[model samples]
Target: MPKTILILGASYAGTATAHYALKHTIPSLPDPSSFEVVLVAPSRHALCRPATPRALLSDDFFDQDKLFIDVEQQFKQYGERFRFVHGRATRLDTEGRVVSVELVKDAGEGEVTLEVAYHALIIATGSSTPSPLHGLNSSGRDELRAHWTAFRAALPSAKTIVIAGGGPAGIETAGELGEYLNGRAGWFSSKLENPKVKLTVVSREEKILPLLRPSIAQTAEGFLAKVGVDVIRGVSVDSVSPPDGGRGEGGSLTAKTEVKLSNGQTLAADLYIPAYGTIPNTGFVPEGLRAENGRVETNPQTLRVEKAGERVYAVGDASNYARPAVHLIMEVIPVLAANIKRDLLRAAGESPSGEDRVFKEDKREMQFVPIGRSKGVGAAMGFRVPSLLVWLIKGRDYFVSMAGKMWNGQHWAKET
Candidate 1:
């Protein structure tokens, strides 16, 4: 009887753990058949969300067909050793070590239910962004593509675009819009003289990209200004009328929005995009194992869910780890895979407690904020890099190739 290792969410962290465990653990096990890895997620494909800011504004930048990779196709070579369940995990039974999922693609029935028991569970459900930027909201590839189509159709006619939040998403969006209206990039013709062609970014923080150093943040601000993006800092969006509305049915806004700021001012725009970061998708996570914001609480060193015993772990946005990114998730996978292997070995009566591996998040945080296809800003290994370097490293392709690697070469094909 193989010990089933069930993983929740097939986003970056969850999928990486599955692949690493298969590559590292099975061969080392005394009996390779002693364990099986099962990955459960809402979508049957991986959405390349980082490209959303650019893609939503312009079609030439990214191919919608390549934005997602079918989950099954990416792991087909692994054979029966791995399994991908296309469903949402609605309930978790910690005591029984079982998870209840509602299948996304059921054939005959109204709703399909599945119960999977596991020796270990990894949560990597990721997170969701607000509308007009449904970057991580859809459950499948088709739905995600639909979201992009809607956004593109809505953007062309819009004369004014207001973005809330000064994080990477907001800043990137405003940058792209600024360039589009300036006739620098994108398909939109130059509206340089059109006062109606407005682009603004509102941030609660005093500076944009607060996670970066003041100098780096300033560099980003300078670039945005050059592209005609108006920056408003130290205030938040208090309310948006047509509040829940966005571009269309699938987006957050159905029509133009009248936005109210915390400072008691109003700004009306043709489009409003919220880039305030993600809302954790941990609703199914047990309250005891979760933090205030519903992110799983994990032991800093071990990366195991705090107070949820050694069998459960979490990573990416679903975990308490702040600022989840593809780079960080890749960094955390090895340690997480090793820790799970150690636990399995102990269960098999092989390793002792002292020999168990533990994970530590990289202390030196890093990120790249691309303004458009040819210019941007970034910090790597605690040092800021110039815009040209940012463009060469990430801005050009927006790390589409990296996303391709995540999907195992099925999407975002490399140029030969």
Candidate 2:
């Protein structure tokens, strides 16, 4: 019987780990057929989160279909060695090495539970943003699709759009909207330039993109100004009152609302988008193993779950190893894959080839802020990157082309 390496979440981290394990780790093992990978996730597809900012605009700006990759189909090439479970993990028994999953069911059906035992576990459920476009709320595919549809239907009529949060999501979203409504040419051209649409971004911090250098933030602000986006700093959105007719069904973004600011001011918004604050999807994880902020307490060097015993690991936004960023997740996968392989070899009474890997958090300030399709600002390794470079790197299509490669596991490091 094959030992199961169960992976939770199907987004960037979980899917990448699964592919790395199956492609590199299992094949190099003393007994190649002694292990299998099981990936459990609520949604059937892995969301291409980077492209979501443009994806929320009209289909002319981006094809929303490309924003999601079917997770089950991505694993079919592995045949019986890989299994995809469409469910959400509700509880984890670290001592017993079993996870309790709530299988996804039809709308009217009663709940169904499943207990799956694993030899090793990887928790990579990631985190969720207030806006479904930026991150998964863990409500599954249907709700996500509905939210996309709702946003699309509402965008045309929205006269005032207020985006709360000065983080990357908020800034990126504001840029996309600014360009789309102000008529900027991108990967796809949209002739609809309605400058009448008012765009605003609210940030609690003193400046936007606080992670980047002040000069880079200023440059980004300049780009936003070119596209007619207003930046409100030093105050947060205190409360939001829905439109007179309410937020419509499912709390959709269709109706107008009133936003109250922390500085005692109010603004009427036709569309209210909360783009700040991410909640880690780790409710099933034991409290003792989690940090006070609700992220998994992970070994920064080994990527293992601290105090949860052997063979339990975490990566991506769900873990407290480093600040959450797509670039950081890429750096984490190779280290985690190598460690898991070494640990598995020892458990199977075989000598592993390489020494265990250690992950060191990169301290370099790296960020790319695309103000619009044509212009942007960024910095890498303590140096400022030009606007054209930023546009060429991410602003053009938001790396949508990489989505397929990510799902196919080709992005993993060539050597473990």
Candidate 3:
């Protein structure tokens, strides 16, 4: 009988631990034949979300190598040693070390009882953007794309646009739209006709990217100006009323509803993109499993989900790890891998005890805030990140290509 290791979710945390374990442990194990590794996830390939947005905004920035890749295909040459199950997990039996899964596809949904008796488990279900921008919400990708395509087609003619929320998503959209206006300097009527062709960003927070320091916010405001984006700070939108029944030349289809802001003010727009916040998708977790704020709570060091016990775990944005989960895939989690290995080793023998496997992860956080594609800003380790580096790293398509490498190494590396 082979010792089994089950992995649930293969985005950043799940895939990293799997590849690390397979590449390092499979060969070093006392007996390669003694263990069987299985990975369970949807979409066989990992999706580079940071990069996905670029496919919508900029074409010059597109790089084929940066696109997401399939994990099952990456290690398929390894044969049956690694098994890939194509399904969605519906229920979890922590004590029994089994997950009740369902096979989801384009046509319809199906069910499968994948009994993974594991010596170890890795959980890495990531977070998701909560609302829709341009009708592109998570109502299902097809529905979103259908709405977004129609909205984008209508943008060229809109004389004014109102952007709600002053977060990174709003900032990025403002920059992109402003650049488009700037490019049409002489051609478009919106650019030639009136200086009041407004591009407003309404933020509830005093400053955008409030996670960043004061200096960082100041620099970003300057960048927005150069790109032709009107920075509306210190005020909130009260209400938005579209050109009613008899009202004249300009009307907006997308933003017909009235939006009331915190401050005593009102505004209207031909377009609106709500790049607001993310929500963890743990509601789908099995009944007995434990979670907080739609996320699975795991031991900070061990990555072992509390309710699920030894048989299950979670990673990426899905884990209640007491920190904003970053999408950067390179930040290593070797300690988690080591702990999983030790647990398996112990199961393989009479007693699997070894050195302390936990190592403190870096407490500091880092971000690369790109204002459009030309300029950027970032901070890490309490250092005010220089603007130039921010553009090079995050601002230019949000570092999607770099993260894709960590998730899908083989095909992406070859593409480059």
lDDT of model 1 at position 43: 81
Q: Which prediction has more favorable TM-score, 1 or 2? A: 2
**Superposed Cα deviation of residue 131, candidate 2 (Å):** 1.6
Candidate 1 lDDT over residue span 189-222, tens digit each: 2223444368889999998897788888887887
Model 3 residue pairs with clashes = 123-313, 123-314, 123-315, 124-315, 237-261, 238-260, 238-261, 238-265, 346-352, 370-395
Q: How close is candidate 1 to the true structure, as a TM-score?
A: 0.91
* C-alpha lDDT of residue 108 in model 3: 61
Regarding lDDT, does 1 or 3 come out ahead? 1
Give the lDDT of residue 220 in candidate 2.
80
Tell me the lDDT of candidate 1: 0.76
Clashing pairs in 1: 245-252, 245-253, 245-254, 246-252, 246-253, 246-254, 247-253
Candidate 2 lDDT, 1-416, residue by residue in tens: 67999999999899999999988988988888878999999988887787778776756765656677788887888899999988999999988889999999887989999999998899999998766766556866567667778887777888888888898889999988887877553334232234567888999999999889888888788777666678999999888886321223455555677889999999888888888888999999999999988999999999998688789999998999999987888888889988998898888888877677999988788988777787888888888999999989988888777667878877664864
What's the TM-score of every candidate structure?
A: 0.91, 0.93, 0.79
Residue by residue across 254-319, what tens digits does model 3's lDDT show? 543355567655555566554555666565576445464767877766666767765466767777
Best by lDDT: 2
Worst 10 residues of 2 by lDDT: 185-194
